[model samples]
Target: MKYFKYTQYLYLVASILFLISVIVKIINQEEYGLQAIIAVGFAIMFFVRRRFVKKMENNKKNL
Candidate 1:
């Protein structure tokens, strides 16, 4: 499977943003539950993005 280099960069940026948000929430002692939920949301989004990318690659290969 192939991905644009820019897509990989975007993913890396997203991961860093998620990590920073989680750390900031923890350090600030904000609602840990909300923080956890947001983190999970980010994870789910990442998963979906990867799945879609994979599907697109598969379709391209079949064509």
Candidate 2:
């Protein structure tokens, strides 16, 4: 349960990074492909973190 807090922070950071990548791609015509790839990676990490955090919380309750 305590460590779940860290996962929550990770989710926030991942979301921020994803948004930043999107913004970077939108503002700059060049390197759009790189930015898109980064954004996709961040998005995947964000969702994974979200699911892991939920699982952790559930496990704590089961304890």
Candidate 3:
């Protein structure tokens, strides 16, 4: 369960990589619509998962 604590950061890292790819694509004058969308999705997931994990941890603490 403690390993779950750091797994959320992996989403953040993936989001960052996607964002960087989006930037690179933009610089290269390539289409990045889908990549941009996926990047945003990952960013959103990171926040949502982090919140969910924190809530779960709090619940575990209360148990």
Candidate 4:
């Protein structure tokens, strides 16, 4: 549980940084490639976390 909380915190920080970068790039009229990559990366992270949490819940029910 502690580890999960830590991971969640890390993801939150990463998401904030990604958003900040995207905003900065937009303001500077830079390319959108980096922003797209960051968005995809965070999407994948969220999907993975959701799957893991679901699996954990299933395991708890089985126990």
Question: Highest lDDT among the candidates is held by which one?
Answer: 3
Using all chains and alpha carbons, the TM-scores for the candidates as numbered come to 0.57, 0.62, 0.92, 0.66
Best by TM-score: 3
Compose the digit string of candidate 1's lDDT tens values, residues 1-63: 355523644655666676787788789977566656665666676667777887788888999
CA lDDT for candidate 3: 0.92
Question: Can you tell me which runs of candidate 4 are displaced by over 4 Å?
Answer: none
Q: Where does candidate 2 stray beyond 4 Å?
A: 1-28
What are the clashing pairs of model 3? none
Which whole-number lDDT from 0 to 100 does residue 22 have in model 2? 72
Q: Arrange candidates by TM-score, descending.
A: 3, 4, 2, 1
lDDT of 2 by residue, 1-63 (tens): 577567656656765776786787678755566656765776677677778878878888999
Name the weakest run of 10 consecutive residues (lDDT summed) in model 1. 1-10
Ranking by lDDT: 3, 4, 2, 1
Instruction: Show pairs that collide, candidate 4.
Output: none
State the displacement of the C-alpha of residue 38, model 4, in Å, after optimal TM-score superposition: 2.2
Q: What does candidate 4's lDDT look like per residue over 1-63, in tens digits?
A: 647634754665686788788888889999867766876687678668867877887888999
Give the per-residue lDDT of model 3 (tens digit) for 1-63. 787788888889999999999999999999999999999998998899899899998999999
Q: Kindly provide the TM-score of model 3 when superposed on the true structure, using C-alpha atoms.
A: 0.92
Q: Give, for candidate 3, the lowest lDDT window spanning 10 residues.
A: 1-10
Model 2 earns a TM-score of: 0.62
